[model samples]
Target: MTSLILLSGWGCDARIWRPLAPHWPHGLEVKAPDWPGYAGRPSLADPTSLTDLADAMAEDLPADAVWVGWSLGGLLAGALLDHLPAPRALVLLGIGEHFVHPQGVSDTALADFQRALRRSPDIAREHFLRRQLAGEPDPTGSRRALRELLGTALPAPFATLDAGLEHLAHLDIHHCLSAASCPVQRIAGADDPLLAPEVIARADQRIENAGHCPMLSQPQRLATRLASVATAPDAKRPESTS
Candidate 1:
């Protein structure tokens, strides 16, 4: 059976994809695995790098699967394209090769949030979550509900969170996009404040009226899109301008 692996982003657990579980397409096996340090997993090893972190997550994923990733999860999936034995394709939601964007989340703003996370993880996490949904029509309500679904941004050993931030700050998958041997499909929330609308529109597909976290705002709609992604022929990868 073709496996459909759903990878969650930073500050989130496998349960973040729970809302879309019942709506997945029939026949394909679906699984959502927690990142190295989230959910109930213990702290990531010392000096955690993106390579090492993706390696750790590799164990839980299938060698050949249609991987659907959100935010940080999308980045992880991109990094692993070279590692998977038979990666079918990749569907990135609310993320791209580079996290820092001038029209999106500025480097300075993200740096400030990273520093705040180091000094006060809880407060910074809450603020970060709020910002994720700021583009939604109902930011207050979405934040309140999504806050519970995603759980805490910080698990044990705050360094893992720091390391995750480091990955976001530095790691760019510009190389991976061109090197990828498998098909790639990019999807994003129409109202995501974190990522520019132009970026999302450039994707192979896009969701409407959703914020950075589409699974929570429009789970059914997102699920339908994933179904289409699964059934469609291999999507063409965009040529790199670099």
Candidate 2:
């Protein structure tokens, strides 16, 4: 049987994908892989780099599987494609070739976000909910679910946040596009304020009406797309650019 692996983004847990799991096509086993430090796992003194995290996850994923990743998870999935034993395809959601950090937004912006995380997690949580899930028409339930998932995890270290932000600024998967032999489908919200439309256009982009968290904002739609991809014979692999 084919397997589907869901990779959640930073500060997010598997619960983020819960709404979309059951809707996947039958006969496809689904597993949501939680980030090491983001799902009540023990804190690492030193945070793992995106590559390291992907390498570690590759060890556990099925030899032949489809990877569905969101945000940071999408970046990691792209980074690990070459190493995965039998990664047949990838479905990226709410992520891009690189993360957005405006020119004027100094590194302090990340530091400030981290400080807020330390001092008043609730406030930080609220801001994150507002930014990530706010665009949803009915954000209340999604917000509540996010809060509960976040509560299960320990606060990500300021250093982790800093490293993530730095990596985000520099991440460019364009170079690896040629290396990905399998299909790659990217889905982003039409109104995602964080990632520009051009970024999605750079990949096999699919625009959704939902916000950054389409899994919550439009689970059925997202699920339907996944089902189609999983069952399609062609699977729509990326064309060789070389």
Candidate 3:
């Protein structure tokens, strides 16, 4: 059985994965650890530093587990490949080569979000959550499901949330993914508003009728996609995209 490490995106904690838990394939060892400053975890001195983030997590992250990261989490996971022992495989969910892109979130929009985060963290988080469901076929249903799965878990610290946005603004790991020694795979939501159309089209698999939070809207489909990755030939490589 393959060991799986699940990483959630900004504004969310490990609890966001609760929806996928029931649908997760059998015989897989799954671990979902909150990022620093989340779920009572201490904040990094410099949360913006990928090196700091990677080093902070190095000790606990098993070197052999397959890592699946979503959104901002995907960027952090990609950065880990440069600092830690490569995992058996690295899976990126609803992530593009760059978080801030001409085809996706713009620099100005990101800066606006940073300002919003400072003004009202609660509203900012609510807005972010709603945005994630924008492209889903049934966004209301997706939002309701997400709310249920996330329950009442507290959001991460303001500093951590801000730092995550900083990463989204600057990090570009297309090079990292292309250079990784381990197999790299991508899974995208067919209607993901946060990802570029070309990026979604290039993914190893795309969950239909879903948006950015496929794990909430289509957990079973997402789980099936992951199971396929676990069973794929080790020699399989990521497809090149324009």
Candidate 4:
């Protein structure tokens, strides 16, 4: 049986995947590990490159696990394509080759948030979490659920936040996607203001009316979409669906 590795985005712990737990499609073992330094996990030793981060996350993963990553996690999955023991497939969510986007969060916007975070990690974490939920159909309920889920688990050290931001600033796998050894699938929330529609439409699958954290906003749809990726062929072919 193939296993699935679920990687979380920046400022989020593996706990963020809980909503999708009941929605995982059949026939796969799913594992979500706290990235180095987030959710109280220890930071990777001398992690000088994206490859280093990938290695640290891979230590416990099976050689053939399908990697499903969200936002910053998506970028990490791309970096691991060569370093990992060769995954069965890769699924990228709410992100593409780079975190900097035209229709999404810009460098200036992120820089401003980073500056605020440097001042107070707690304040920044909540602020960022709320900011990430843009385009949610029900702001009241979604915000409530998101806040409860994030309750007291964040405000992680600045160093851990910086580690992830470092990759967002420098990592670019657009040139490397062609060389990926496994099947690649991209999925994003259709209403995600953080992701450009055209950019996400390029994905193999997409969840409708959802935002960056589709797991929180549309768990069932996201789960079904991921099931599609898990069983997909190992190829670069892109599918346009909403």
TM-score list, all predictions: 0.92, 0.80, 0.93, 0.90
Q: Largest lDDT belongs to which candidate?
A: 3
Q: How accurate is candidate 1 locally (lDDT)?
A: 0.78
Q: For model 4, how does the per-residue alpha-carbon lDDT over 85-133 read when each residue is reduced to its tens digit? A: 7677878888888887756777887788778878878888777777778
lDDT of 3 at 223: 80
lDDT of 3 by residue, 120-168 (tens): 8888888888998899888898888778766545577888999999889
Q: Candidate 4: where are CA atoms >4 Å away? A: 153-155, 232-242
What does candidate 1's lDDT look like per residue over 29-64, in tens digits? 788877776766865675256557666777776767
lDDT of 2 by residue, 1-242 (tens): 55778887766667778888667777777888676665555444556465566555655566577788788778767777655654767877777655654532235665676677678665675676667776666678767766665564434555564455455555666555556777778777766656665755654556566778778778888888776666662455555543
Whole-model lDDT for model 4 versus the true structure? 0.76
What is the total number of backbone clashes in candidate 4?
A: 0
Alpha-carbon runs more than 4 Å astray in model 3: 151-154, 233-242
* Per-residue lDDT of 178 in model 2: 57
Model 3 quality (TM-score): 0.93
For model 2, which pairs clash? 183-237
Native-to-model Cα distance after best TM-score fit, residue 222 in candidate 2, in Å = 0.9
What lDDT would each prediction earn against the true structure?
Answer: 0.78, 0.67, 0.83, 0.76
As for candidate 3, its clashing pairs are none
Segments in model 1 whose C-alpha atoms lie over 4 Å from true places:
151-153
TM-score of 2: 0.80
